[model samples]
Target: MPFVWAPIPFPDTNRIDMALTDKRRNWTPEEDVVLLTQVAADLPFAADKGQVTKSWQSLADKLVACDHFDRVVDGRKVQNMFTALVDEHRKFDMASAKLSGVDQEELEKHTLLDELLPLLDEVKS
Candidate 1:
């Protein structure tokens, strides 16, 4: 399920429309602008334009760095790690298939060694 801005209220009739919209899950430039604007407006006079902009940008960056951002420049490193783990799992499954005739204990050991070690290695790499 997509994350919802639970603090914000909406009309009952508009629930379906809001839920079905891509805006519910994805962040966009316009929404970022609006969020910055609203947050800036709430700030005291001591906060200058640069300060507000920087704070807003930082918040946006942190949100994007979170797992939900999916594929993007900021997400490349995490995506690579995720892909490597998946690939390692596939390789382990293939290796296990080749040893199908082995005893159950041996198969279990092979499964763990073939899968987890490579996945951990990639994480360290």
Candidate 2:
């Protein structure tokens, strides 16, 4: 069955991202930008490693090394975080796919906003 939320007031914040994390600390988009920059810088080295799995593990290790802005992480945590990021992007893409005449920028705004609305509905016990 479909569920609905009662009408409640929310803050007039510009955007409230639900604070994704490795279950220990929150990761900001700014931190992600820095981490991704590091990944881009290290990707060539990771690519040189033979198998795809090893290369991914190497990347995960690098991510852990760069986790200072957030919580401490290991390869497995990095792997999980990476999977989450990919999943989020894919979900946005899938949502955008069904729409016509929507530009990437608009779609991104809508997708981010859409994700935030539900998160705002959660109440603490």
Top candidate when judged by TM-score against the true structure: 2
Between which residue pairs do clashes occur in model 2? none
Q: If scored against the real structure, what TM-score would every candidate get?
A: 0.25, 0.45
Find the candidate with the highest lDDT and give its number.
2
Q: lDDT of each structure?
A: 0.45, 0.53
Q: Residue 101 deviation, candidate 2, in Å?
A: 1.4
Q: How many residue pairs clash in each candidate?
A: 0, 0
lDDT by residue for model 1 (1-125), tens: 99777676666857777656633455443433333333233322123544744544454455456464432332233233334544755786687689877854434333433544454455456
Q: How much lDDT does candidate 2 score? A: 0.53
Stretches of candidate 1 above 4 Å error? 1-74, 101-125
Candidate 2 Cα outliers beyond 4 Å, as residue runs: 1-23, 44-68, 106-125
Residue 117 shift from truth in candidate 2, angstroms: 27
